[model samples]
Target: MMNPFELERYFARWEFTAPFLLSASDTEPLAMSELLRLASPEMSDAWANLSLGYTESTGHPLLRQAIADLYTQTASDEGGEPPHAISSDDVLVFSCAEEAIYVSMRALLKPGDHVVCLWPSYQSLYDVARSIGADVTLVELREEAGWAVSASEIEYAIQKNTRLVIINAPHNPTGSMPDHDTWRTIVKTVEGSGAILFTDEVYRLLEHGDAVPLNAAATSSPRAISLGSVSKAFGLAGVRIGWIATRDAAIFRSLETYKDYTTICASAPAEILAIIALTNWSSIVSGQEAIVTANLKLWEAFMSDHESLFRWVRPTGGSVGFPQWLGEGSVDEFAENAVQEAGVMVLPSSVFRHGNPRVAMTNNFRVGLGRKSFPTALDRLGSHVRARYG
Candidate 1:
């Protein structure tokens, strides 16, 4: 049986009700009008003339082309190799990134195969594999180590029967990205072991400061899969558009077939909006980056002021950061109190507990810096912490 999704359940209970939500991972969302304004003349016409009928099961042709363009481009300026350009045929659209993860896992993994996953991940990364009867090993990202990905540990974890290796860059919860050398080493390791690599890249292109974005994994290897969504970086969660890109023709076909069993096709309107957002990708992402950059500065000051109550390792990328709680009570109790007393919702580490018995949970909690309201939320949390902890 598939395990419960505790993180989402916690959000279901508190996300709407909380007065100050400091645990959201996506960048601030855009209004429909704002998004439309960003659309090209051709896309605007498509949206204006859009039919409400079912979309192509694969995806809108234009949307697939736009998504293919994303992976075709490389970040060689960031010191990575030029990607092997992928065409529309290499892209597969899903209703959401969660669906993409589910469909891909169901199609690629089988009973008794070994899988290695990064710890404190979005649960579905490993859980779906387990649901299919695959053996999983979670390599932990420790708070003491600033939550860095350990290529050596990942290499060590792979076994002869390993079929898949999963990793999230600009990782959820922690927001730490691996250095280029480390990332390359991991890709090469998985390639040598004959295991397919699945990289969660929803948080790509949101790297802050001196941190540069890594090349898309699909560009690196034929068997590698790159998962992307407009929710996090483009703030289009309401549209529910996401996709998977790969150079492996067989895996692409497998994912396409499995998608038929679930949401056979994406929402017609969502695909139109996603095309606009992705077509104007640079500008939309720039807006999000501005908000994240400004909010991160506020968090820096807040963390400095309350350094005694939390062990903070500043996140290099993404909108979320996991900090170790140093207060007298457990983080669960503290988070509960924050919600009840301050109407602030924070994700305690318990929500991220790994299914593996050998992997221990930490005292960390996630804080989000992506939304425009983050500064105000930080103020509320800071006041609450000082009033209660001091």
Candidate 2:
């Protein structure tokens, strides 16, 4: 049996009950009506006459095409040729990104296989590989190093048995993203080792400031797989739509077969909504980015005012960031008290524990930077910090 997912379990207990979910990774979600309003005439008509029957296991054709367009657009921006463009056949939809991870790992790994993955990440990234009896080497990103990924570090971790290398950009919990050259090095390293590169791009298109989104890995390497979802960047978490894009036919067939045992298809309405969101990708993502930009300033001011109590490697991308606790007690205690007394829910580093004792993350807690409610949440947290830490 697989181990319990601590991060999700914590949120399961507090997410709906908490007054302020200060550690949520997704942007403020869009309402159904708001999303519907953005749909094209063709999609509107499809929604009006939608069937509630089970969808094709491969996903809706139009939905797959729309998702494929996302990769193609990014490829084109990078001066890619037609061969680099992702087609609908290269995209396979999953019930959620979590399912995509689970199914993909199941398909690609076996006993004695070696996997390399990032730490303080979504647990499913590594845990599923372990459950399959694969040996996993975690390349831990350090807070002292600004939570950065070192290509050399990853290069050293590769073993002859390594079959997979996983990386999440606009990383969860910390919001640390690698520079373009570093990303290229990582891709090259994984490719040279003959390992499949599985990049979690769920937070793609949410880059802050002048940072442009990286070209989809599926577009650049036949051995690379890019995972994405409407949950984070598009702010449609409730829809439960996510997909994997890859140019590798053999692995694509394996993932497709493995999916047969899980959710055969996604919800019909959710698929329709996802198509609408992807079709208007720019406007939807821009709105989410606007929230992050505004809330980032609020977070900066809060951090500045309470500089003695916390320190963080300011996040350059994504909607969430990790901040270290500089107070007298454990961050776990502080997080518990914050929710019970301050009505703010912040995730402690304990929730990200992956059974690797070498990584000491007790000093950190996650804070989300994309919510419209972030300002109020930060105020509540600030008040609590002063009352307790002082």
Candidate 3:
């Protein structure tokens, strides 16, 4: 039986009803009016005259070209080859990054295949492989070391039959990022083991400040594939447009074929919106970065004030944070109480637990520094902790 994503399972139950939601990975989503202001007037006119029919399953050519350009831009920003390039044909657009992940994993995995994944990641990385009856090995990130991953740990997990390895960099929950050196080591490890690397870079562009992101993983090896989306960094979740960008023609063809069983193509309207979003990318990213910066400041002050109750290695990139419950019972129980009693909802790390015997299940919870309501949610959380556990 296939295991469903626990986070989505939790959200399906409480997301709509929860009064204080602090667990979302996305920064505050942009409204259509704000999006229009960022885009050119011609884009609005295009929306007005949009056709309501099936577009190319590979994606609209213009949309694909814009995404290819972004990968080129990412390569340049991350200090890669001056001739950095990926063709629009190398990209396969999907409904969302989550679907991109599923499509990639499903296309690559087979019965009896062996897969290794970075632990405490977005569940689909490991669970999807497991659900396919593949042997899934998880290598844990060092939590106390600011989510640092050692090459030895990853190398140790690799086996002769290892078919795939996945990494969600600028990672989820913890928001920690790896340096260029780490990326090289990881690439070397996977290459040596002869396993394809699947890099999830959906959160890569959300990096705040001057910290440069690693080059797209697809560029590291012919077998490697990278995923990107318009949701997180650009705050355009409504568009629900995401893609798989790769240098390998075989991988691109495989996923594109598998995508037929899934959502055949993105909506016509969303494709137009995605094209407009990418066309106006700089302004969209900058606007969301400003929101992330302000929210981070508030999160910092709240954690500092409640030192006895919370402690964290502040994030270096992305908007999610994992904070320890300093004075508490089970953090899972505390989080539920906060939601029900204080109307504050923060994700307890329990939901992300992978059965890796090497890693101790943490008593930490994901604290999202993405929403404008973060301060009020923190306030309610602090008050509840003081009353219940202080």
lDDT of each: 0.90, 0.90, 0.82
How high is each candidate's TM-score? 0.97, 0.97, 0.95
Q: After superposition, how far is residue 368 of candidate 1 from its true place, in Å?
A: 0.7
Which digits, one per residue and each the tens of the lDDT, describe model 1 over residues 1-390? Answer: 988888999999999999999999898989999999988888889889989999998899999999987765535435656657778988899999999999999999999999999989999999999999999998998877888999999999999999999999989989999998888889999999999999999999999886768888888888999999999999988999999999999999999999999999999999999999888898888899999989888877777788888877888888898888888888899999999999999999998786544445777899988898998888898889888998
Q: What TM-score would candidate 2 get against the native?
A: 0.97
Q: Quote the positional error of residue 185 for candidate 2 in Å.
A: 1.1
After superposition, the stretches of candidate 1 with alpha carbons farther than 4 Å from their true spots are 77-80, 356-359
Off by over 4 Å in 3: 77-83, 355-360
lDDT of 2: 0.90
RMSD values, in order shown = 1.4, 1.7, 2.0
Model 2 C-alpha RMSD vs. true structure (Å) is 1.7
The candidate 2 region of ten consecutive residues with least summed lDDT is: 74-83
